[model samples]
Every structure is written in structure tokens, then in C-alpha cells.
Target: MNQPKKMALIAANLAFFIIVGFFVYQRFGIYLNNPWTRDGQVRAQVIQVTPRVSGTVIEIAVVDNQHVKAGDLLFTIDASTYEVSVQQAIANLERERVSSKGAKIEYERLKDIAAKDAGAVSDKDMIRREVNYQQSLSRITVAEQNLIAAKLQLEYTHVYASVDGYVSNINFQIGSQAIANQPILALVDEHSFWVFGYFQESQLNKIGMGNAAVVTLMGYPDTPIEGRVESMGWGIAPADGTVGYNLLPSIKPVFQWIRLAQRMPVRIELEAIPDNINLRFGMSASVLILSEEDSP
Candidate 1:
């Protein structure tokens, strides 16, 4: 090759190396400035949908993974028993009212007789009648309370969603028996999405409350979600010295030469999400805490 061509090739190679070196340096600087973690997960509030009244499910208003709003019907329990209870309560209340009315009439008649003639009605008889009337009135009040309770139980037969969320984990059918206070399904709150980043304890000093963050979901790599550090976990479950066989404390042996850093959870509250982005529970995510100067 000619000497001029050789000189030109050397110059080009040097320039290319210089450019690559500068780019690498810039990336390293960014890495040091921002604490990043791929051990992150998308989280949300999971509500256990429990039935307040126990009965056989008669109708299912929603299916698995269906989006539901607040006050939407989730399922209907067979309300035949509840209806009977309400009817029985009404009958008892009516019976009490009639008894109370009869008692009041008797008490007033006795009083009127005693007033017209001083000794016609005995004092003992008058006092007994008044007591009977008061007892009847108390019975009526008790009956009324029973009626109210029966109606409330009937209303509970129709289970409704408590919040705006998605219904999940539906394992029951129309004929399934639902026990009171037992969680039959799960509801993931749509508006309560957040991310938990398991960052190394050593990197905790760089992360603070209200620090700006960028989250990249594994499902949506190109679109980055904005967030801020909401809080940090105060402690994590211990891995050693737990109760084991024979009621003795179990301790795991550790290597002294290689010590692994403990990871602490940092909660990141996501900002307003875009229309196209869909956040789901338990999704894998990567989080980056930007430096104060780099944050907008």
C-alpha cells in the first residue's frame, strides 16, 4: 500500500477508537449515577371477595377475569331461605302488634272503670294490666328489630363488588356452596398499581423518598413508565434462626469469604399511565432511580 493510504487508515482507526471509548465512558457515568434493578415486580391491591351470607350460588353475574365496577353484582346466592326468614319476621311483628293493641285496650278499659267507680277495679289489677301492656310493647320492639335484621340478611344474599376492579380466580359455579366469610374470588384494584424494586442494601443511600424513577416492564420494553419512590421496606423476613425440628432454632451456615448483599424492597408509585399501557399484577419490571439533577 502507498504511504499516504497507510497514514489515512491509521488516522481513521484512532478516531474510531476515541469515539467508542467516549461512548463507553458516558454509559459508565450514567450507571454510577443511577441505581438500577431488574429484580422488580408490578404490584396492586388484591381484595378477597368474601360472601357475607352462606348459601348455594344461584346466579353468577361475572366470569373469570372480567372487569367490574363498584356496586356491580358478582353473584347471587339462593335467597329462598332468606325470603322465608323475612316473612316469618313480618308475621311475628304483626302478632306482637296485635298483642300490644289488645293489652293497651284492656289496660285503658280497667282504668276507665276504676275512675267511674272508686273500688270497681282493684289497685293490684290495675298495676298488673299496666305491666302487661308495657311488656307487650317491649315484645313489639324486639319483633321490629328482628324484622330489620332479617331484611339485612336478605340483602346480603346478593353479593356485590366493593370496588372498581377485575374479578379473578373464579372457581365456583352456580351450584357451588359459598360459606360466609370465606374468600371465593380475588379482585385486583385497577387504580392501585405500583412497582416493588428489590435493590441492594448498599444502593439504599442513593435512593430516597420522592426520588424520580423510570420503570420498564418486561412486557413493554420500549415504553418507560414514570414513577417516584413512595417508601422503603423497614425490614425483611429473616432467612436463618427459624424454629425447626425438635423446636430448636435453625441456623444456616454462611461462607465468610463471599458475602452477598441483602436486598431491600423500595416501593415505586407509578404516575399517570398512558392509554396504551396496561399494568397487570405480578408482571416483571426493571427500575432505575435517576439522580436529582437528571430528574425532570
Candidate 2:
């Protein structure tokens, strides 16, 4: 072959390979970005167990990591103070009731006397008796409310599980002072298990709500959990617009040359979880969306 002919053939082959490679790269990129992401995590609603009434924890019923049903006793606070308050409230209510009864009798007596002999009960005196009776009624109402509140407080001493869940680490122990409204433990909601997938915004067109998805946990790669897209997050914190200590929006400089697509979180509600598998919050997960034809 002539040298010029050989050089032309070499250039043709190189051009053909380049063309093929370019198309392959584009196809590969599409495949890589469309349907799956490793940036996912098993998440659930965590209930922060805060005490409603403050007192020393006299008894701890369940240990950390123990699974409990709704209404299960968690721990008991010292009910001595709450009990005393309840007794005092009861006593106050009883006293108020007796006083109210006596006032009503006195008012009725005055009313009867005024009806029989118009001059017997003066208008001012009748008014005073009626006012006293009404005041007694008001006091009784107040006492009744106080009694209810005290009973509620006494009941609050025995904290119970608000949801069926596995208890997280309990920071407080027996004899620990649990302050009112202070979170001492956390409960990982068992039934609220869901997976959150962070997908690139550009890839969202391929995903939709109610779309079937498969989640493979990092710990249990062999078992895939089935789920459906529940919802998409409405917003995220802007990376460039971070707040400073001065309470001002501190905009950061961005690299103008390359703009990466931001990832949006999609919530996936897991179907019935297998008994063998225990889903916990913040577990690493990989999510893949199934095509309509591929879904069962």
C-alpha cells in the first residue's frame, strides 16, 4: 500500500472510534444518572420522650433499646408531690362544695323571707347574700378545675409510650431528676419507617409520586425492601446562603464555571417490613426506581 493511503486509513479508523466513544459516553451518562442513587437513608419520626411533670425518677420500667407498644409504661416519676397536690386539691374542692351548699341555703332562706315579708330582707342584704352564693359557686368551679389539673399532673408521673417503637438510649436512671418538658430519652417510631433518597434535580423528571422503588440497606444488601414514593421535599437550605453569627445572610462565592445540579429528597414509604429485618433511623440505604413495565 502507498504511505499516503495508509495514513488516510489510520485517520478514518481514529475518527470512527472517537465518534463511537462520544455516543457511548452520552448513553452511559444517561444510564448512570436516571434511576438510582446511593445517597439514601432509612429514616423515621423520632419521638423525644420528655417528662411533663418534674420529679425524681423512682422506677425505670423499660431499659434502652426495648421495644414498647403505645401506652406501655416507660418510667415512673416520684408521685409523692403530685399525690399531695391531688389530695390538697380534693380537700379544697370538698371544702368549697360544703361552703357552696351552705351559701345556697342562706340565699334561699333570704329569698323566702323577702318573698313572704317584703320588708324583712333588705335589698342590699339580699344582693350581698346572692353575691356570696355566686362567689362560692365560682370558688367551687375553680377548685374543680384545680382538682382535675392535679389529677392530670399525678398521672403524668407515670410516663407511657406515646407510640409503638424501640426506645433509644435512656439518659436518665432511677433517682435521676427529670425536669418537666425536658427530653430524657428518644423513641424511634417503628411503624413510621421510611427511606429518603436524594436525587439530582435533573433526574426528577424520571421519578414521580407513587412510583415503585426498591431500597437495599447497606447492612442487608441481599434483601430489597419495596416502597412507593410518598412525596418530594418542597425545599432545601441554599448552600450559598448560610447564616452568620450576626444573623445576616452570608452569601458565599460560587465557582461560575461549573454548576452542579442540586439533589432533592424524595420520601419513600416502605411497605410491610419483614419480621426478620429491623429498620432503624439513619441506616444507609440505596434506592432504585423501577420502571412501570418492570414493576410487579
Candidate 2 clashing pairs, residues 3+ apart or interchain? none
- Which of the numbered candidates is closest to the native, going by highest lDDT? 1
**What tens digits encode model 1's per-residue C-alpha lDDT throughout 155-234?**
99999998899999999998999999999999999989999999999999999899999999999999999999999999
Per-model C-alpha RMSD:
3.7, 8.3
Model 2, 193-284: lDDT tens digits are 89999988988898978889989999898998999989999898887657886988787766899788899999998997777788888999
How many angstroms is residue 96 displaced in model 2 relative to the true structure, after the best TM-score fit? 1.2
The lDDT, on a scale of 0 to 1, for candidate 2 is 0.91
Q: For each candidate, give its TM-score against the true structure.
A: 0.87, 0.84
Q: Candidate 1's error at 16, in angstroms?
A: 12
**Which regions of candidate 1 are displaced past 4 Å?**
1-28, 114-125
